[model samples]
Target chain A: MPYISTKTNIVITKEKETTIKEKLGKAIELIPGKSEHWLMLSFEDNASMYFQGKSDSGIAFVEVKLFGSASSSAYDKLTAAITDILKEELELAPDKVYVKYEEVSNWGYNGNNF
Target chain B: MPYISTKTNIVITKEKETTIKEKLGKAIELIPGKSEHWLMLSFEDNASMYFQGKSDSGIAFVEVKLFGSASSSAYDKLTAAITDILKEELELAPDKVYVKYEEVSNWGYNGNNF
Candidate 1:
């Protein structure tokens, strides 16, 4: 399973949220074995966030967590794609967006470890 | 640096939010080199979440991200502390809460990697 959560300073409208979700669904496919079927998503819009000690401009922090590992090249492509999606949908500059990936060794669900 | 983000299905009031933050501030100290000073926290209450394909009761997902590694025993302590905090503040059962940890090798801030 893979989970992608986005926190952004800019407000996300329902339409924008849907578009971003769709784009991210496609972006996650860059990984070899991950797909949107098992991808969980979350978005926090108009979040109280600061970058470089400033919050006057739009910024986005996206966290991608997967159950297993992926290649560096795969991560590189996914990052580029995520940045482009934020830039296109939220008007956030490429530099203002930060995407971090975590390969989770242990995940829990349904009151038990997975 | 360490960041703790919590997502739950229950609505978090202002008072509850403050209380949880304070409790988590103390909880982070369970890790040897970590403290509240460098802790950045985010809470997503009333989020659309599901467990075992159901959403009838309260559920929480907590994510802890650190710049470096920590021992498993340290994680165990933090998990218990976090679970207690959620249980006391949000009234969520321990079994319904999932805490995941990520140790990042590359972290970015202020337009550069750390």
Candidate 2:
């Protein structure tokens, strides 16, 4: 399973949310064996966040968690795609966005480990 | 640095948000060398989350990211404490909450990698 969550200081209109979701759905394919069918997404708009000890500018933190690991090259590609998606949809500067990936060894769903 | 983010389907009030942030600040101490001074927290309430193909119940997904590594036992303790906090504050069942940890090797801050 692959999950992507975005937290931004800028307000995300419902329309922008749908567009970002769709873009991320396609972006997840950058990693082999990952697709939107099993993708879980969350968007937190107007989030209280700071960068460089300030929160005046627009900022977005996108987290991508996968059940297994991917190559560094794959991660690089995904990061570029994610940055582009946020920049295009939210107008966030590429430098103002942070993308993090975690390969989870233990994930629980429905009262059990996955 | 340590970052703890909580995403749930329940609506978190301003009062409850303060309480959860306080509790999480204390909970981060379960990992040695981590404290609230360098902690960053984000709460995504009323999130569209589903578990086991259902979204009818109160479900929480908590993610803890550390700049470095921590022991598995430390993670276990932190998980228990987080579950307790969410259950006590939000009345979510422990089984319905998932706490995941990630040890990050590269973290960015202030337009630079940390």
Off by over 4 Å in 1: B1-5, B9-43, B48-60, B64-99, B103-114
lDDT per residue as tens, model 1, A24-107: 877889999888766667777888999999999999999988877999999999999999999888889999999999889755
Pairs in clash, predicted candidate 1: none
Q: If scored against the real structure, what TM-score would every candidate get?
A: 0.62, 0.61
TM-scores of chain A across candidates? 0.95, 0.94
Each prediction's Cα lDDT score? 0.83, 0.84
Report how large a share of the reference interface contacts model 1 reproduces. 0.13
Docking class for model 1 is incorrect
Model 2 C-alpha lDDT per residue in residues B11-74, reported as the tens digit of each score: 9999999998999999899899999998999998898665443457897888888998987678
- Which 10-residue window of candidate 2 chain B scores lowest in summed lDDT? B48-57
What C-alpha RMSD does candidate 1 show over the true interface residues after superposing them?
Answer: 4.8
Task: Give the C-alpha lDDT of model 1.
Answer: 0.83
Q: Per-residue lDDT for A6-108 in model 2, tens only?
A: 8899998977877777888888899999887666677788989999999999999988888769999999999999999998988999999999998996554
Clashes in each model (backbone N, CA, C under 3 Å)?
A: 0, 0
- Candidate 2 has a DockQ of 0.20
